[model samples]
Target: MTPPEAALDTRGTKPPAVLSCPQITTLRHRADFLRAARALRQGTQGMLVQARCRRDNDPTIRVGYTCSKKIGNAVTRNRAKRRLRSVAAEVLTEKARPGWDYVLVGRPGVTVNRDYTDLLGDLNYALRKLHAGQDQ
Candidate 1:
């Protein structure tokens, strides 16, 4: 059977896919996450965002997404992460600042069920607060 993407109609009804997630570097090491955790935190209804300005001048934006077991079982966690990835692809590409590392943590109940537009708004608000030159 043909894949869903390949089975698209000639009428062009299908919307575009998510951004492939390569525009920004990914934060892999535990240290990178720990450091961002120490930097700045902004919480929204859907997710918690941690942002940190990197010391180096690389000008590469880095991002990480995580859903703890508290969020749910493996499948649930994976779903939450997928949604987070999709939202990040939309918001981070433009709103996220260069030379920064950000971690998006999924909340237990809300992350999985929250409306997608609200989720996007949550990330945008968190980013704005972090960059508003607050106490930091």
Candidate 2:
């Protein structure tokens, strides 16, 4: 029965990680997603990866994640996307090429059920094939 402002002390609680990884720029525009879709794409057992060079001289790596309704209802789709984001953070931060945009498309059943390590392997392999000859 205390005042509303005085009753709250949840500052240290673990909230959902919204800006957990700051090094990787997140892609939010539909145009960017479409541009990446028109570019190179590689698929693995866990997910589908689409990548494109922006050619705009920006050293930032931008990425987007998507989950279709085919994955399931809202909860399932979100679960798949969350997994995709987690895997992306682990792999893209090190392996993704700068000045590029990437879109990670979640699979219907594979994304949420696949083992985390295997998901990492899938992303690494897809990236290797996507950026095969461009590396220096």
Candidate 3:
């Protein structure tokens, strides 16, 4: 008979020891968001993306999400932010450059209601535009 620990089927059950890509960080400071505000911006049907390259050599990407009160009451604003966060995580984790900060601003009518695929496309498109503008 096999030992208890050896009896378990662990073929595809083991978790990865390490992630392929570096993990992303969240921007929580007011100064960081303010600084990104002065950087390149691209607006899509769903949301606005603001990106700023940092001087440091950190390999982690930082992101922030915000929605104005004009979007609606507290519930509405939170929903918009939640959608933005999901889209950012999906799109920015692979595509966004390191040593940069990005902020996703929620639009009143478009953010919470837009299709998920369209939101992802918008974020990808916005990032491309922001980077292309930087190279010029």
State the TM-score for model 3. 0.83
Which lDDT value does model 2 have at 95?
89
Local distance difference test, per candidate?
Answer: 0.90, 0.90, 0.89
Rank the candidate models, highest TM-score first: 3, 2, 1
Candidate 3 lowest-lDDT run of ten:
8-17
Candidate 1 lDDT for residue 63: 94
lDDT of 2 at 135: 54
lDDT of 3: 0.89
- Every candidate's CA RMSD: 9.2, 9.0, 5.8
Per-residue lDDT value at 64 in model 1: 93
Per-residue alpha-carbon lDDT of model 1 for 1-136, expressed as tens digits? 9989678688867767776433587889999999998999999999999999887877678999988999999999999999999998899988888778999999999999999999999999999988997433
lDDT accuracy of residue 19 in candidate 3: 70
Instruction: Residues 20-101, candidate 3: write the lDDT tens digits.
Output: 6866999999999999999889999999999998868887899999899989999999999999999988998788988889
Candidate 2 TM-score, C-alpha based: 0.82
- Candidate 2, position 121, lDDT: 98
Q: What local lDDT score does residue 69 receive in model 2, on the 0 to 100 scale?
A: 95
Worst 10 residues of 1 by lDDT: 14-23
Error of 2 at 10 (Å): 44
